[model samples]
Target: MSTHTPGEDVPVRRIDRILAFMSLGLLVLSIVCFFAIMIGSASGADMSGGVWPLIGVVVYIAPIVAFALMLAVLIMSFVRRARANRGG
Candidate 1:
């Protein structure tokens, strides 16, 4: 009773793809920042100095925000596809 045939590819929206890419980029940046912070700390750099801690906080938070956005985009895409399939 399915409209789609077996082995058919499901189409993804452009916005969803863009959000996914953005999320991935944010995750990569977060990881790089984490390593940089660790190395800096190990090298006796003052984390509390000037803007370092602020940079650290923003980097740590970026992935969470990016992932949330990506999740929203994915859910919206899924709902839109479902509605379309239902002939709404």
Candidate 2:
């Protein structure tokens, strides 16, 4: 790492922050939904109506989208680091 002071660090790109936050939000949502489903099942609550189907869809889809977003963030981060190193 460079010896730059805290106030002089490399700036994070706006898109990178957005992608990272999106990934984090989706991941948290999926985990919450997964646990909700588990608790609902364990308590023998009805799983056939209301928010169950929506929760099920979120459980299935959120992780995949989160993973994709994380991958994108990683790629962008790497690219930015590489460019910085090369130019410096």
lDDT (Cα atoms) of all candidates against the true structure: 0.80, 0.88
Q: Write the per-residue lDDT of candidate 1 for residues 1-88, one digit (tens) a residue.
A: 8776444445787888888888888888888888888899899998888768876986879889888978888788778777766666
Q: For model 2, give the RMSD to the true fold.
A: 4.1
What tens-digit string does per-residue lDDT give for candidate 2 at 1-88?
8664334335788998999899899999999999999999999989999999999999999999999999998888777776666665
Q: Worst ten-residue run, lDDT, model 2?
A: 2-11
How close is every model to the real structure, measured as TM-score?
Answer: 0.78, 0.78
lDDT of 2: 0.88
**lDDT for residue 78 in candidate 2, whole number 0-100:** 76
Best by TM-score: 2
Which candidate leads the pack in lDDT? Answer: 2
Q: What is the TM-score of candidate 1?
A: 0.78
